[model samples]
Target: MTKKDHEESGLSKSVWSDADLEEMGWHDATVHALFLQPGEMASRLLLDLDYPVRWVPPVRRRDPFTFWVAPATLVFEEVWDLEGSLDFKGLAPELELDGIHRLAPPDGRAEYPLWHLEGHAFELKFRASGFRQYFRQAPRHVAGPMLEYADRGGCAFTEVGFD
Candidate 1:
């Protein structure tokens, strides 16, 4: 991928460029191949905090990784939307280094006072700047103040889209 073609991978064009990312010899497909489930890839990053990944499975395929060793990246137009500049940028990395998992299935729910995390199957969403944990799936019981803070900060969580 080239900086001029940043749109091809649906990465944060503002934060990453094709040319810069190419220096690392990695593509969305390359990371996707490393993980099987949808949140699996992002969870690795969130857990390790070594990279920022946005994995979107192709529209035709319901599964993010069709094979155990699928190395090809899927092409799609949708992307995750994140807003506002980060204040505590170190939060993500710190959390990951502490051995924390920030993804949850719909059957499970976790909360951290002001924030919550929830996911369904392959889908996941986190709504906090630097949470010690993940989001809770309980939609109705979410913290109103935390959500309001997220809203004021241009949506605290990154909105992911699948093709």
Candidate 2:
């Protein structure tokens, strides 16, 4: 679905907008994995927040603000082009995201937007027709190690006796 459609549907409501991301602070967020699909159909970038944010219920406000780390997956659909320099080898190799930016479509690509994902040691540039962010699971009070544990059918916290 388009960004507007996702917004109106409520089911896939965005957890954070550009301004919200900036305000909440996504700098230094850990990127555990980057998945590129065949045929450039889509790409998924998994991230673990460096600084957990306070959780605010949608229906009501609560006292004693609860902080949580919600791992997120950014899906870029209809990827037209993707270029990156990254290595996923070594012990729990991960990238520290400097920032993620949504830029206007490049020339001759009016229908797609360019996404720039910058990290401490790598950079990814892509053009996709659609994009969405999905939280992997319920928020946890503590941020686990920077790794794609959920995708591998494991819970980082559980392994560390934090669950």
Candidate 3:
């Protein structure tokens, strides 16, 4: 989505503005972000599938071990510019689900499938505002086995990754 469209969606109007994004020290050009904590069942399934997985050490001093054994699926959500669509290397292919409507009015539900590939990510989900959008994961990370699956191939295991 364009910056204006993302802002016009009113998801984060109070926190940022188009003008504010132009500031010299602006950190990002999108709206909100989410760090998904996977549930037990999902995590177990990945391990059962024998997907390549690893745990990376946490970069932050306060954070717990970078590598962890959890039973849940994890994904990062962030509002970003159009450029995120570019890279797709080393990412796992995903099954794209379509036609899921947003739950909220004005702002609808956002849901879609994402495959992490070669330093990039692919997503096809609807946002909370009822807008159907796709996403590509960007660089920047905390290492872990989950990331190891980023380079996996073939469609057989794609559906297993999502909830």
**Model 2, span 1-163: residue lDDT tens:** 2322122212232244343444544455666555655564455443333323334343345434333554655556677577888765563556777777878875867667787888777788888765545554444453342334553334221111111
Maximum-lDDT candidate: 2
Return model 1's CA RMSD, one decimal.
19.6
Model 2 misplaced stretches (Cα beyond 4 Å): 1-25, 40-67, 87-92, 143-163
- Please give, for residues 1-163, the per-residue lDDT of candidate 1 as tens digits: 1222224333322222222422322122111111122342232212201222333344566644221111112111111221222233444211111111333434343321111211111222333223211111111112111223232232122222211
Candidate 3 lDDT at 98 equals 17
Q: How good is model 1 by TM-score?
A: 0.17
Clashes of each: 7, 0, 37
Residue pairs in clash, model 1? 3-19, 29-73, 116-135, 116-136, 117-135, 117-136, 118-135
C-alpha lDDT of all candidate models, in order: 0.23, 0.52, 0.24
- Candidate closer to the true structure by lDDT (higher is better), 1 or 3: 3
Candidate 3 stretches greater than 4 Å from native: 1-65, 73-119, 127-143, 147-163
Worst 10 contiguous positions by lDDT, candidate 1: 112-121
Model 1 misplaced stretches (Cα beyond 4 Å): 1-5, 13-48, 65-163
